[model samples]
Target: MSYNLHQLHAFTTIVSSGSLGRAAALLNVTQPALSRTIKRLEEDVGASLFERHVKGMQLTDIGAALLPHAQLLLREAENAREEIDAMRGLAKGTIKVGAVGSLAAHFLPLAIDRVLGKWGNLHVEIIEGVWDRLAEGLINYEIDLALSTATNDSDGIVAVPDCRWEDNSFVVAAFGHPLRKKPKLTLADTLTARWAIPPKGTAPYEHMRETFLSRNLDMPDIAVQTRSVTVLKSLVAECSFLSWMPEPMYDSESKAGIMGTLPIPGISAARTLTAFRRRDGILPRPAARLLDELRSLTERGMAMQTTR
Candidate 1:
């Protein structure tokens, strides 16, 4: 049976608010008007939606059965309206964005600022997570877009080629670390030293493993396994622990003499930092604009800082 959106909206509002008076107040309609709307809806459906009571209104069996369907219809209608608005470039919906820590910390702010300045109705939420979590979110449609260390496409997702940044992150330590002063630091020189590494499944860990194996060396023991950049940076600066990180992660600190890359050859490797989205998902106009801004920002030169 065909149903009007207004009837479904009123029905859902009444169910949510649990009383005619409250629903009227919530919908900003007079009680008689709301009652008539509900009555007309009941006529259309040929079922008593609510069993009126002295204390409050309770949904009848039919109302209980139809409540979920009505809510779904209302949600779909709202989504359709938002999509139309987005197509018109009238920014008025929440855009969910996922990103790794470095992108969230350094690049996201600028991109967000650019979008927020022009569109007052736009809202963006930053979900800071690793590639595994964010990638899963993108595939499952929970995230609208993701900035990741992955350049390649996975199942049900694609990366924007223009938004990708090639990076060569390096093994680093504080300037005061003995390895930094080594006249000729070799692969064996770092094997026994304490290391701070990311969780086992991350890019940094894989890069470290590949760096050692390419040179015919085994992976070394890690002193700490952490996901917090703050903790990793602190350990590398205050202790003798060597850690691998992208240049942007330590640039300002490096200039302050708190961090520096170890000049070990063959240890640095190239990886792409990319912005990704689901292949089947279409972004709202505001989010699409922000995605374009992200591409522009990265393309203009997201350069790694030189070690001080």
Candidate 2:
């Protein structure tokens, strides 16, 4: 059975507001009317979406499953309206993007600046996370695009082959750290060094692990493991802890002479970065515009590299 936007809106609003009275006030409708909307939607779905309780409405298993689809439908409807408005010469829209910390640090800001310069009315929303979180954002329609390291396993997302580039990862330390003064460095030299890195099973962690394992060396015992970029940087700069990171993530620090990659022999690795989107549907115009800027940026970067 088909459900209308009104019913879905009422359902989602109630989910957000947590109670019928609050949802009714937010929707500017009587509580009875709001209740009728959910009743009709429940009838169409043939499932009890929410369990009534003294505290608030809680989603049943069926409602939990339906929430993502409902949100996706609402987002697409908004995109359609924006697309038509854009066609009518209204250059206003929002671009939602998710990216890993590395790309978010340098690459994405450049593209976003270019896009906003062309369309001043456009808005951008960005969230930083690892690949798993970015993939979830894409699949749930929370983000129109994802910037992350290239991966072979894409369950519900497709990579944009033209929007890919390479960046190098390196073992880094604070500029004045003792390790920086070492005459010569090797992976084995860092085996006993205090380290701060992303948690195990994350892409950064796995890459760091492989860097050691590939050299027939056991992984170093990490002194601190975290996902927060700020915390990682603080530990590295102020605490003299070493960490593995992509160059872009530490570009500003390196430029400021606060931190620099340790000159370890044969320790750097190049990783391919890619842009991705959902497997289905045309990308919204705003997101597409940002993607174009990203492609241009990548091409310009590659050209500069070739010239060098």
Candidate 3:
């Protein structure tokens, strides 16, 4: 059972404009055409969506319930059109992008390369911060899209679905340590160990906390907490501390047998990644297209991972 999108559009316009005449004026169609649209929509929905009221047309119970979905559907359809236009080189605009350090270093650059290759003149500004701070920037309207493993959805922000990807992260230590050669590791095994962690409010900190608590363990004793993972990486190389670093970072060191990740049983690599846009405004077309490309790239990456 499918209802026509145009009818829903006409019904929404009539409801919002408060009268058939006003809706017709707003839609740039005649009153008769708009009426036919609503009548067709009501028959398809199997209910009367509005009733004559003193002000104009009042939404009946079914109409009231359906209004939000209708508006959303129409907006999404328009966004799709805009995305098409952008791809065809008919739309132009700037997109401000935000990301934490690692995502800026790893994924976003590749996505931007694809975006610019397609659009030719897509103006993009990159804002760098830790995830929590980047999310705050979004809430404050300082940035348009954020790429991160964690998305703290809040007022005035919407998290885009199907935007997350899996990351098989590692717990790395300098090779000189006694436990470095161990083939297996556990949450309990790492509990008493000193570690360099991102501060408590950021993604890495929360991920570490959640992973431990999920295993029924209390917070591991952290030796240092800082926002910079670059600094933390250098710290891990010379100290006895353990830190969660993505597997790709240690691949070079692993070949030399100077750094390695402990294989923790019952644990696999995973992470939540999301793209955020403002809740209250129109999304610029070019940015939206870039998001689509990013989504496709992420899907392909996940498929390759599954195959391997």
Top candidate on lDDT is 2
TM-score of 2: 0.85
Q: Give Cα distance to truth, residue 95, candidate 3, Å.
A: 3.4
| lDDT tens digits by residue: candidate 2, 110-214 | 899899999877899999988888888898788999999888756578999898888788899998988767787778989889999989988898888888888
* lDDT tens digits by residue: candidate 1, 1-308: 89999989889898888899999999999999999999999999999999999777899999999986786566556656886786577746767788876677667777888878876677887777778888887755566789878756766788887786666678888888887778878877988899998889887788778878988889889889987878888999998799888766787787798887788876667777888877653464556878878877776774232111
Please give the distance, in angstroms, between residue 87's alpha carbon in candidate 1 and its true position after superposition.
10
RMSD of each: 7.0, 3.1, 10.4
Compute each candidate's TM-score over C-alphas.
Answer: 0.67, 0.85, 0.61
User: Candidate 2, after superposition: displacement of residue 122 in Å?
Assistant: 1.6
What is the Å distance of residue 105 in model 1 from its true position? 3.0
Q: What's the CA error at residue 119 for candidate 3, in Å?
A: 2.5
Candidate 1: count of backbone clashes, pairs at least 3 residues apart or interchain: 0
Worst ten in a row by lDDT for model 1: 299-308
Decide which is better by lDDT, 2 or 3.
Answer: 2
